[model samples]
Target: MVRYLILRTLIFVGCLALTWLLGLRDREEQLLAVVIAAVASLVISAVVLKPFRQQASADIAERVDRRVERKREKAARSDEAVEDAELRRPAGDVDEGGSDSDFR
Candidate 1:
């Protein structure tokens, strides 16, 4: 954003200088000065505004990514916890015919 500001400021100053120089020529009309200034201002405003808007969009994307990652991590942790609990549980009580023979 700071770089964009500097670049836009340079452009504005350069355009204003050019306008001033052009106005000095005998053939140029005074309206040319106004036109140049207006065009310069419009261009500078657009140039300056572009990066800030882009940065804002990037910031939003970063936030969304962070939120998604946190959700995924939390989900994974919850699933792991449930799996651990399941693992710690004892086997179900069931009677098999000839349990001693089965063990043998």
Candidate 2:
């Protein structure tokens, strides 16, 4: 992520400099220069930074998948614990004559 961000920043700065050198250096043309630089950087990065962007995206996806797997494992462990507890309870502890809500 950091690598991608730094590279993108460099591209923007390069584009900004290029725009300035291309006759948009006047104070009144500052906004135009920035807009052009931004667009140019975006296009350039889309082509030049494709690999880095894909790598960052894949990294993020992998992290999310790992988190989801961990959550699933935790839920499974909790379910097993509940099942084990249920098994350990005395079968006669429940009143056969009443619904579960009777105790609540």
Candidate 3:
């Protein structure tokens, strides 16, 4: 894990260094681009890889337990998602028929 982070950070810095060495006379934008790319990569890695890493640390049995718990919670809440009462309310009040009152 430590090595992976180091390697990724090194790559990010390397890009910045290379751009500078290659004489990007307008390096302000070039460096900013690298910073943006690095931040985006970090955000994506955090969202995607971080969760998977936690799962990887656990034994198979533990992982399965966590997974089954998640599934059960998801299944329990499944009905409420479609049962949002406001949306299910009658549309009679909405007047989608486009009568004369629409122009008024």
Candidate 4:
């Protein structure tokens, strides 16, 4: 991701420099120059940075998958613990009171 950002920045700067060199240095032309540079950089990066983009995407996906797996494992462990506690409770114990919501 860092590499992709750096490369994309370089491409934008290069395009901006090229536009300035082509006579867009004046204040009035600077905006146009920036717009053109941005568009050109976007197009260039989309084509040239495909691999980097893919790698970054894969990295993000892997991170998300790992996080989800960790959450799933945690939930499974919690459920197992609850089940175990339930099994250890006295079978003769019964709730004869009102619903818990009544306390609230």
Q: What's the TM-score of every candidate structure?
A: 0.46, 0.91, 0.31, 0.88
Which parts of model 1 are misplaced by more than 4 Å?
Answer: 1-46, 93-104
- Which regions of candidate 4 fall more than 4 Å away from where they truly are? 95-104
- Model 4, 1-104: lDDT tens per residue? 99999999999999999999999999899999999999999999999999999999999999999999999999999999999987986775555663333254
Task: State the weakest 10-residue window (summed lDDT) of model 3.
Answer: 93-102
lDDT of 2 by residue, 43-103 (tens): 9999999999999999999999999999999999999999998898776676666544337
RMSD of each: 10.6, 1.8, 14.0, 3.1
Which candidate number has the best TM-score? Answer: 2
Compared with the true structure, model 2 gives a TM-score of 0.91
Q: Compute the lDDT for candidate 3.
A: 0.64
Considering summed lDDT, which 10 consecutive residues are worst modelled in model 1?
Answer: 93-102
In model 2, the number of clashes is 0
- Per-residue lDDT of candidate 3, residues 1-104 (tens digit): 45456655665676556656666648367766677657756665676566555555555568789999999999878867667764766656454565433355
Clashing pairs in 3: none
As for model 4, its CA RMSD to the true structure in angstroms is 3.1
Clashing residue pair totals per candidate (backbone < 3 A): 0, 0, 0, 0
Model 3's C-alpha root-mean-square deviation from the true structure amounts to 14.0
